[model samples]
Target: MHSTMERWSGRVAVVTGASAGIGAAIAHELVKKGLKVVGLARRVEKVEELSSSLKSEKGKMYAVKCDVTKESHVTLAFKWVKENLGGVDILVNNAGVAIDSSLIDGSTEDLKKMLDLNILALSVCTKEALKSMKERGVDDGHIININSVAGHIPPQDYFCMYAATKHAITILTEGLRRELVARDSNIRVTSISPGLVKTDLPPKVVLQVSPYLNPEDIAGSVVYVLDTPPHVQIHELTILPVRQRL
Candidate 1:
């Protein structure tokens, strides 16, 4: 086993949006590293299906039906983790959405949903995880936020608000890091930015890119960041496929 991974064996991790795509990939990767994982998503049956099939892996995986946008659900989800699986050693904030709507003519409901899931939900999960880590004195816990290339550049192809939400994640990652520094804490925070990943995105959104990255590519980055020694924090990771210009 990898040296860093060896230390995480039997530890607890919470991965949001784990029903499918990059979120599901990250959950699977971590469980393979021997970390007990709780996969949270609105459509948790998918996670349950994946979990049942992962019985032979080094560590175990479970599902939590959580709608991250709701504060009550987020709180209840973390509460269940505390009461059941124990303190969290790692948190992967991977729930997000992208739509094929321009800000100029987009439905307000669509824009609000983007903000709720991408920004508000991520923040809530981070807060809940930090609360558990602090209460448990978990010095080496980590918080990983899944960002995007859209976060670092101007919006394109009618994803302006979605890009804006990712930009918020970019700043949020830094802000959380600074807070930890001020508190003299060892907990690590990372933001992973990947470009043009091929997943279940709408065809309109998918048509704009070529040679896209696979979800596993992003999941691999999550493992790399988590597999680092405690003193090493990957503050921001931006991955773009060779042929992807954006």
Candidate 2:
């Protein structure tokens, strides 16, 4: 039997950095699939615009102003979800950045920003989401981390620290899975790694290749993963442009 999103209809989902690019696309797709979505981003107006545009979709969208690098912001965001939406059944940790710095000669501030947003922020969001899931007995809750192909490969010039942070995500995803298994919880954790997506996150000067993947492509992968059977778990999924040699 094929998997379907019927089980997740009307459920609540928290998507970080949902203002634009991959996060926006994922939020849009999830709303259309009938899941009530809360979009968290620093650019609150952008998310509000998206929510407004998606007014007639099968589900609803709420905009929350958030800077994921701040733990307090993430905490408040989840608290709001708990109070207003009961709890979150899904969390897409898509807030990430690729700095214009290198490991060898990178500014400490730049490296810290990458680490704080990509790794620390994701961990905190997972912790909050898991707490919400546990409190409400949501065994089928899913945590989808928006990772990058750089996580699985060596650093490439300017992406040195960014790659290091993504590598942390790869390990963190597995670590969370192990902890869930130890507790015998049915909650699922997934990492979706895409290569060279056409997004503002990556610097344009470094994109010297043709045929980059689009934000919608990653969004489609997220939908596919979420629609899988309850018995299925897609731990790691890597997507790349067909002709691009990584």
Candidate 3:
């Protein structure tokens, strides 16, 4: 089992929204594979508990309190990662929120909140990660952006703002990939767009929706992307439960 983790023995990874659900699972998976992981989330206590439960010789875990929407918090967190565990080699931009309401009925503030956290924070974190990677001379770094099927095919009713934010993330991921490639950078940018995953969203939403993908299933896709060789870049991967319609 340990030998299987050799590929990631010396790598450093950072996962945002990592206190619970998919973010936490991704951090656990990476640490199991021998990558030192820094879990960033607003729920510091939860992330601390998560970090304490990991078991790996070559890999370690750290918990940082971060509200991704805040630029100063992100900056401080990244700086801490650099000072403590070395520079980041992989960054998982997974912090997000869901605000469901019809376009006309939605509060402007709510819409802005979704956009700020989902789209703006992702950009901030990516920029910071890229800067650190470049400065550290990590020629082959990976950035995994967790998007949603909502990004590609939006629902007919409700979730207008949430879906729009996701769409923006999709576009950003693609554009960043192009930019990195044009610059001849070895860094890889990938977007993992998943259908409704089983998470702690309001029960009403899940009850209305048919089948949802498991969080681990999405995490598996992330691990797969990271495990791929440097020569191959998986630009976009959309995953849905078999029973999902669109």
Candidate 4:
């Protein structure tokens, strides 16, 4: 068994935005590794379908219909995890959104939505997960942020606000790390920056990049980070396709 699989087996993990895309991929991988995995998303139907499909895996999967933007919903979700799966030992903050809106022409609603999901919701989830872990005395917990390349460099015209949110994530991850260190906590935090992954892209666009990455690639990295020894921390990792210009 892999280091992570060995250490994390039989533990609980909560993954957000797990209806599809990167979140789904991460949830699926964790389920196969024998961790009781809870998938949180607003689209319960889609997550339900995924649950049934993954039922045969080594571990178990439960679907929690949640709206990350709402604090009430996020609170209910962590509560559900506690009531059902006990507590979380790992949190994959994988829920994110990227809509087409520029700084100059952006709708207030659109920008607000992006900020809520991309930043606020993520912070709420982290806070809740930490509470659960602490309640259970899980000092060796891990938190993985599914950040983007835009967090490092703002993309072209239409992605200014999105970039701003990602930049905040970079700081958030580092800030959280510092706090954890100051408290002398064993909980580890890591951030992954993936460039141009083929999530909702068309086959034509995906094929344009000779070595474009898939959701599975990122999922594999998540496992790698968690698999490390308790003392080792993979602070930040960046992955990109060979053909990606940016």
Candidate 5:
């Protein structure tokens, strides 16, 4: 099970929501693997701190302040990448939120927030990445969506809308794959779904599942999918903790 990661050294990757949690972890791992990483987060300072800490690593990490919900910001961020570092070869749509609300009586604002960031933002980023790849003739580019088990099945009453947004990701991932195949493109799309992880996204009152996954665990999954043979496409990869019922 050797990784062809050596081929990616010095290539560019853009990771969204990289200030903390899974995004930050993935950025760290990619940097260690010698890929130039651009970490996009509203809290750009945190990513800067991470960049400083990883200065001695094999690769490098660049921080950009980006609010994924804003389409203009996303557009300019990719533009900056093109001017500064050529273009992006990999994109990780990891910025997402889950508000504790119900569909039956949920605040419309909360639902919209989830929809905008989780679904619309991911789509926008994917479009930008695919455009960059196409312009640069990067047929081997990859797009990874950091999805969840909730997207597969609503685990709790409060997470119904968030789950709905995730389900949209599942569909979007396959849809992109099909589109790429139709074009005879080597670009790959994958959805990495995790059951439970100790992250700040979940509310404090939410039950803490024991033996839960770590942000690094999901990061490892990202590396796994990216390391596969160029001909092998991993359409969906679901990761869960041991004894995780939901």
Candidate 6:
């Protein structure tokens, strides 16, 4: 194992949307590095299965059923982390959904759901994570937000609302970095904008795109940002497959 893998020995990490896809990949990577991981998702059974599959006893894994949009559930999940896993040193805000439809034809309810889950839930999770970091006196903690290339530039069409939420996340991560710096907190905030990751977005939207990147590729980028030195901050990173135009 590399030195970076050893660096995570005995640390605590909380990953939202960790039942499958990129979130699960990140949790797996963290465990490989010897960090205890708390997996939060709405699907209790799936998360439990993932947690149980981990091979290391030195690193623990816990699955917490949580609907990120609900403040009560999020609060409860974080509280459990504090009590059970010591305290969170790394928080990955990766729970998000996409509702793809032309703006004129998009259902208002779909847009609302996207905003609530993608933007609002991310904000709520970051807030709770910061509180835990402060309480633990854990200077030099990390916050990683999984943004998208759509956030950097507008999409062709039908992706307006989904892109909007990502744009908000990009802005949120930037603003959060400033706030932590002003408070003289050692918290590092980073946003990773991935281009066309191969996850189950709606089939209709997936059909419109070209080849996609793997979720683990995005996860690797995330680990890179998180493993950086305490004094350095990587504000924004964009990762895309070589053939990808966007």
Best by lDDT: 5
TM-score per candidate: 0.96, 0.97, 0.94, 0.95, 0.97, 0.94
Give one digit per residue, the lDDT tens place, for model 1 in 142-230.
99999998999998878899999999999999999999999999999999999888788747445464768889999899988878888
Residue-by-residue lDDT tens digits, candidate 3, 1-246: 112335667688999999988998898888777788999999989888888888544477889999999999999999999999778889999999987766887788888888899999999999999999989888788899999888888565688788888899889998998898798899999999998778775356674767877778887898888777767788899998888876
* lDDT against true structure, model 5: 0.93
Taking the tens digit of each residue's C-alpha lDDT, what string does model 4 give over 1-246?
A: 336458899999899999998889999999999999899999978788988999889988899999999999999999999997788999999998887687787799999988999999999999999999889888999999999888998576687888888888999999999999998899999999998887763246545755668899999999989888898999999999776876
Per-residue alpha-carbon lDDT of model 5 for 1-246, expressed as tens digits?
Answer: 767878889999999999999999999999999999999999999999999999999999999999999999999999999999999999999999989898789899999999999999999999999999999999999999999988788558678889899999999999999999999999999999998788998655544535578899999999999999888888899998898776
Every candidate's lDDT: 0.91, 0.93, 0.86, 0.89, 0.93, 0.86
Clash pairs, candidate 2, are none
Model 6 TM-score is: 0.94
Clash count, one per candidate: 0, 0, 0, 0, 0, 0
Candidate 4, pairs of clashing residues: none
Which digits, one per residue and each the tens of the lDDT, describe model 6 over residues 115-145? 9999999999999999999998988789999
Worst 10 residues of 6 by lDDT: 1-10
The candidate 3 region of ten consecutive residues with least summed lDDT is 1-10
Give the runs in model 2 whose Cα sits over 4 Å from its true position.
206-208
Q: Which stretches of candidate 6 lie over 4 Å from their true place?
A: 1-5, 202-209
lDDT of 1: 0.91
Q: List the candidate numbers ranked by lDDT, top first.
A: 5, 2, 1, 4, 3, 6
Worst 10 residues of 2 by lDDT: 202-211
